[model samples]
Target chain A: MLTPLKEFATDIRIQQMEEFKARGFGHVGGSLSITDCLAALYGGIMRIDPKNPNWEDRDRLVVSKGHSGPALYAALALKGYFPLETLKTLNQNGTTLPSHCDRNLTPGVDMTTGSLGQGASTACGMALGLKLSGKDSRVYLILGDGECQEGQVWEMALFAAQHKLGNFIAFLDYNKRQLDGYVTDICDLEDPAAKFESFNWYVKRIKGDDPDKIYETILETQKNQKDRPAMIVLDTVKGGGVKQIEDTTLNHHLNMTTELADEIIKQLIKQKEG
Target chain B: MFKCIYNGEKETKAGKTVFGETIRKMIEEDPQVVYLDADLMNSIGTSGLEKSFPNQVIEVGIQEANMAGLSGGLSAVGKKPFMHTFASFAGRRCYDQVFISIAYAKNNVRVIGSDPGITSAYNGGTHMPFEDICLYRAIPHSTVIEFTDSAMTAALLPVIKERPGLTYCRLSRKNCIAIYSEDSVFEPGVANILRDGKDAVIFACGYMVSESLKAAETLEKEGISTAVVDMFTIKPLDTAKVLEFAEKTGAVVTAENGNVVGGLGAAVAGFLSETRPTPVIRVGVKDEFGQVGTPEYLAGVYGLTPADVVAAVKKSISLKK
Candidate 1:
């Protein structure tokens, strides 16, 4: 049985696929993999006002793995940040929805992020700024497992730990695949959780496909009294929620035709109806 | 209208001292101003910030890139962040972060890159940055500035804080020959004419401003009346002032402590060639790396002495039609 949030996530995935189909090509694999987390964050967890996206006290969500912007845009559109029809203009000329997240162009984007590993450091900055201003607003960052290979990520990790940024929470979308190949084959981040643990972050691992588990873990991490930044390693498949592309090895970015996209959308609609 | 007083150097102060004092005052006045350093608190004279404003000062240890990104994040949330480090690390080491995180995101970050160019004496080429200005000038909407002296550093600190965009402040950490009075007002993108002469004009920034003044004094003894303009703001180059001076003098010499290939000399030459043609001579370091030595030794070795500027001035005059 699908939970209410899970059903919402399915709707987001459907929209994301439709947008990609309209564009003809996009980062379909990573985008689909992160939909459940985005659903949970936008649906329930993050304290954001879609109407007044620049509310000073609202919590911030910086998607560090910004190639997955299609999924993030779907969530933002579905939540009324913009009209749902705008999703069709994903990568069209003069479209506000670029392949990566641009804060100035996008209505609800907190920070512009396309370059990998930079968003992590910026998230730490936001958290630090919030704490310095005596605001209790939290900051959430979503990073790719492959994005962790950048040295700046570790630099931010050390800074976040040293500052004891209790309000900063990061989610590593460990989809196990990158643009080139599987992360293990390219450069394995063996014992990824251990790395964050050593950096003094409160670490947790969960199945990313489950909205309930993600929600519960975030609540539990927030309740902890320890004054340290938190990291939740999301164990997710590369093309999660859809079985066809989930098993494909080289689906990091899809060169999809309209036929393939239509087939994926059909399956998603059937799953939602069932 | 600015006067260069040589004999009575009464108001001279170290660049780091003025920087520290000015930042301290700004922090005390504005609750939104925050300071971050890459473990160079004592080196850059901002060590007291940690003690006074504990929450506002962050010492991100030995991580320049992270410091820049963090500054961007703070700016996003309405905190005016001022970050300081050596010039090389501030420009070359963290160029990407400064580009995407700060400039591209449209966040207001004031980066203070102390000990620019040959001023990184004893630290050698490993710490020296001859291309800092060139790197910053390429970024669209970036305001690149090099402080002429302690007074200029003190005057521009608050102005840069309020400016809404990416700003790079290049200043020496040690004492500088003070050029302006304590109350001298400064506006960005405006050049200040220190000395006026019809024979030749000298454009200089950072430590070279003092050198150019000394060269002017030497040229005056030889009956060669020279003009000196403190071209502090490098990007958004004061094209009007540059063209006016070039038209007035008919000959130009650019002196800097950085590489002539892309530093002040290149900027002036490129601008002049496009709009107004003039006989221009560049007096700065040739294509070479810095070496471990005293500032005086390195200045002489790199052909950055007052005598070199005097020679370049003569050459520019001779080339004039």
Candidate 2:
């Protein structure tokens, strides 16, 4: 299970780079940071049907930090929601795969979220609605640590706890960097896990790039949090894989040539094989 | 089958209470219909409903932005969520969320923004929303409906619930002049002609609908026959009806309880300027912020009165070529 999940993460990263290469420039850092978490969910946790994307009882996911749409589109492609070839159409003219996650445009995206701090509240509403309708399907949300600067995120944190949305789960990609600079310099999110804890959410901190840990933490939370929402904070690098991108200071969104993409894909393949 | 019962008296029930009752019926009938409030249930006359439908009625405290996005999320999951808050917060404070999360996302949700304009008389500048109509109308594929009275509030609840995209329902929480009977069935994007005339036409919505009717009566006594139209749907501004009346009358007066810049007056003027150019006089708040005062005092300060409408009608008629 761990080997397949690791390979899934690697494939998502490679395809994400390929899509970015097609688009000339894309949100590279934020998209790569969450690739492993996306792989774990689409591989192990989320209950979704690629053929029936709108299944009423299917578990839903909202990418709150919507700039990471390339990674999500890649995961959806690998999960059979769409063809892998469709990923080349990212941000192109008259394409379904937009730069931001739009539920109407994408097949598996549960909520449309581009503006920060909104998808957090919407995920709570979806969880609450599912609980009200006596459905066991869960709602998973992926938020950026920089996105936490938005007051709406704290508002929803309080709301989800108050509502006792046990079916709601969120992951904060604490990649430590944002568009402008390091999150610590740009309005630091001091002690985010403590913030969620004080807000009464069941909180956990885990290594973000490890697909095994990501899958296990989600399973544990889903079992324990029957009366409270859980917030799993992912401790991650701004650009986790591909040493060339990770070593850079400002890699949030950057130009990725097809040659650079091919080089990164070769490294990923060699690492996976070894 | 639109009937006007403009009897120059206030409705027995407040607009907020009628709205509460209408939603109560919807909640009772459909399990999927959920009511969400930003801790203003009592203000909007929807208090104590949580006891009957605990799962269906949710109180999201005072986070208006959260409530807006949450409503979008609920709609995405097939729940017909009706979110309520002051017009100022519902539109201005949470405008981006409504624009991106709900409207842009194509989520099926209804937002009820109460106490528009001078209706938030005592609540003052902080609570008043003069540009809510403008804010909502600016969103593409969005419905902006203002309730003229209790009957209109009750009648439009069901209609807006089934609307495909985002729908903004603006209404007053307190008593409004009774204009429509209980049996009046209104279709969206159609103008409700209250009184017919050939000299000029007065287009109005919300509390000003009654004022327009009263102005029509006063104009008739002074020998000027003015047509009164309750232009409730502000976004898809009843183009055919507006063109028909502008061609028939050649003079137009727009009355609203909001700022003339982006409210019903602007909609009517912008439409008439492009399609059928006519002499249009706007009777509304003259681009000023609301202040703490009584409803009557605020109306006088902003020139939102039947006398104002009458004067505007006369001016429009005199300006007609």
Candidate 3:
């Protein structure tokens, strides 16, 4: 069971790398950065039927950091949202998987998001709205560490905490990297978990690459209610899977060659075996 | 547009702007109209709504951004949400929330931004957003509108309800010049041709419709036939009508209550400059900040009065050669 699960996630990451390699350069840093988080959610946690996307009671997963489309698309394909072959057309001119996630175009995309710092707020609305209509549908939003600089994010955090939207689960890809450089050098997001807690949110931190921890945390989040919004800070490495692509100065977006893609695929295959 | 002579005032009614009233009616008639206020229910005339539908209304208390987000949520799951707040707060304060939460997500929510432009009165510069139109125009798929009067509001009410997308309407707190009568016409995407002429096109929107009409009258006195078009939908601007006027007239002038930048002028200029290179003069607040004064005084201060519209028309006519 463990071998197959790990293989499935690894295959998803390998496919993501291949697509980026096709484009020659995509948001490699952020895309690779979010693969495991997407793997865990779509793999085992989220109760989403790829065949029935508008399933009224289906849980929602919002990719607030839309630049990480490759990762989410890889996850969606593996989860049977669309044929796994469609993953190759990640950023084509007329493809469903745009550089940013668009609900209008993609079959299972719950919402369209390109502008940073607004997706989390909408997730709060989605979760709260579901609860209001007497449905138990949960919403999960993955926020970029770089996006925390936006003042609107805090406003939403304070709001979610104040409203005690327990049905909403927020994940912070605390990879310590952004578009330009490290998050601290860009703008210090000192202690995100503590910041959320201070804003009256029930926040927990986990190693973003650890599937077991991510899966367990997802279960832990289900118990939240009537107190504060839940936030899981996934402490991750930028450019997660491929070791070579992992910690560049610009740890957010990456431009790589076919040579790098081949080496990354080799590493993943070896990692799958070892 | 219809005009009623009330005490010889000759007021044109846009529609009865009863955002608070409509929500109350919806709550009583149907339990789905969820009214959310940013704690400005009394200020924005939502107090009566709260009394009628206390359970439906959520007073999120001073959190405009959150209120915007929450309202979008309420709308997503079959709850008709009317988020009432000041124009400045709704447009600028929670801009991202409106763009992503409501519009991008395709949530059925109505955003009523009261005290648009100089109408904020003594609330000063920070409150009165002379640039709200420009800010909202940046968001794609957003229904940005300004009711010429309460009649326009009432006419617009039923239309906004049936509309599936996100909508933002600016309501005048104090009564100004009404654009239509009690039972009149109101269309969101379609631009209303108040007056059509051949000499030049006078494209205007929001509070400036009356000013543009007066400006057309002023231009007519000078023997220049000016056509007046109320461009209510700034985003999907009525380019068909505007280009026709430009082709027939050879010159055009766009007047709006907001900044000359991304408001009606920018939209028209962007269209005609590429489609039909006709001479266009844009009369609006010249890329500057707002100031503390009365609405009437601020109009003059920002060059948004009838005089400015007339001057813009004359200048655009000169550029025709």
Candidate 4:
């Protein structure tokens, strides 16, 4: 039986497929891999006002793995941040939706992120600012496993720990694949949970595709009394949920022909109806 | 119409102290103002600020790029962030963060890069940055300024704080010759004509402004009149003031404590070649690296004294037809 949040995730995944099919090319593997976590965040976990996207006390979400913008946009649209019909305009001329997340163009985007490791540092600043101002707002950040190769990520990890940013919670989308190839073949980040734990972040490794587990973990982490930041290493598969693309080894980005896109959309619609 | 009044003292106040005092005052006045440094609070004299406003001042130990992204993040949430670090690390070590996180994202951040150019004397070539101005000038909508002295540093702080977008402030940590009075007023993108003459005009910025003034006095003794313009703001270039002075003097000399290739010299020459074709001679480091030495020893070694400026002025005058 699908929980309400899992059903929401499935609808978002279908919308993401429709978006990529309309565009004919998009980052498919990584985008699909993180959809459930995005659904959990937008649906139940984050304290946000869809009508007032820039609410001062709203919990902030910065998708540091910004290439997964398609999934994020679907979640935002389904949450009524903007009209769901606008998702078809992804990457088109004069479209507000670009390939990567842009805070200026997107209504619900908290931080503009595309360059691998920059969003993590920005999230730290936001958390620090909120804490200094005596605001109870929390900040959530998402990062990719391959994005951890950037030295700036470690630099931010050190900073976040030293400052005791308890209001900051980061999710590492451990999708195991990058633009080049498998993460282990390129630059393995084995024991990522231990790596973050060594940096003084309270680490929680969870199955990313399970909406109930993601929501419960976020709640439990937020309840902890630790005076340090938290990191949830989400064990996800690249191109998860869909079997055909998930089986492909190098499905980071896809050049979707008419036939391939139609087949994916058919599967998505059937799953949605079921 | 700003005038420069030399106080005749070799030192008035250190730029870092003035920056520290001004930033401390800003933090006290505005709750929205936050300070970040790469563990150089003592180096830049901002340790006192950390003591008083512990929550507002963040000392990210030895992390320049992370500090920049942190500034961007703070700016995203409507907090005005001021970051300080050495020029070399601030520019070269964290150029990408300043480019994407701050400038490209259109977030407001004020970066203070202390000990610019030859002012990093005892710190050696590893710490000196001659290419900072070149790197910062490439960012669109970035306001880049080189502080001439303590007075200018104090005057420009509030102005830069209120302005939006990315602002880079290049200042020296130590004291230099005082060029402006304590009450001297300044406007962004406006060059100060310290002295007016007809023979030629010398465009100078940062530590080179004092050298230009001394060179003007030397030329006056030799019966050759010269005009001196303090071109403090580098990016916007103050092309109108440059063109007006270049047209009036008919010859130009650019003096800077940085490289002649892409510093103030290149900016002035590039503008003049397009607007007014004037004979411009650049008096600065001639495509070389820095070494550990005293300020005096380094000035002489790099030909950055008033004699070099005077020689360049005379040569430019001779080249003018």
| Candidate achieving the largest TM-score | 2
Q: Grade the docking of candidate 1.
A: high
Name the TM-score of chain A in model 3: 0.95
Residue A166, model 4: lDDT of: 95
Task: Give the per-residue lDDT of model 3 (tens digit) for A1-274.
Answer: 3455567679878988878878777888888777777777877788888899888889888888988888888877777789878877878889988899887778888777768877776677778777666677888899999898987688788778766687888899999988877789879999999999888887789889877678788787777534567889999988886677774666566676889888988888888878
Error of 4 at A211 (Å): 1.5
Cα lDDT tens digits, model 4, B1-321, are 334678557555677788889999899899999999998999887886777898889888898989999999999888999999999888899999999899988999999999988889889999988888888988999999998988888888888988899999899989878888778888889889898989999999999998888999999999999999999999789999899989998999999888887888899999999988999999989888888988788999989999999999999999989
Where's the lowest-lDDT run of ten residues in candidate 3 chain A?
A: A1-10
What is the docking quality class of candidate 2? high
Q: How many backbone clashes does candidate 4 have?
A: 0
What would the per-residue lDDT of candidate 1 be over residues B1-321, giving only the tens digit for each residue?
344554425345677878889999999999999999998999987887897798888888999999999999999999999999999899899999999999999999999998888889889889988888888888889999998877778888999999999999898988777678766778889999988899999999988888898899999999999999999998878999999999999999998878887788899999999999998999888988888888888889999999999999999999999
**First chain TM-score in every candidate?**
0.98, 0.98, 0.95, 0.97
- lDDT at position A66, candidate 4: 87
User: Model 4: how far is A91 from its true place, Å?
Assistant: 2.1
Rank by DockQ (best first): 1, 2, 4, 3
Cα RMSD to the true fold for all candidates: 1.4, 1.1, 3.9, 1.5
Higher-ranked by TM-score: 3 or 4: 4
Tell me the tens digit of each residue's lDDT in model 4 across A73-168: 999999999998899999999887888999899889998899999999999999999998999999999999999999999999999998899999
Output the lDDT of residue B176, model 2.
Answer: 87
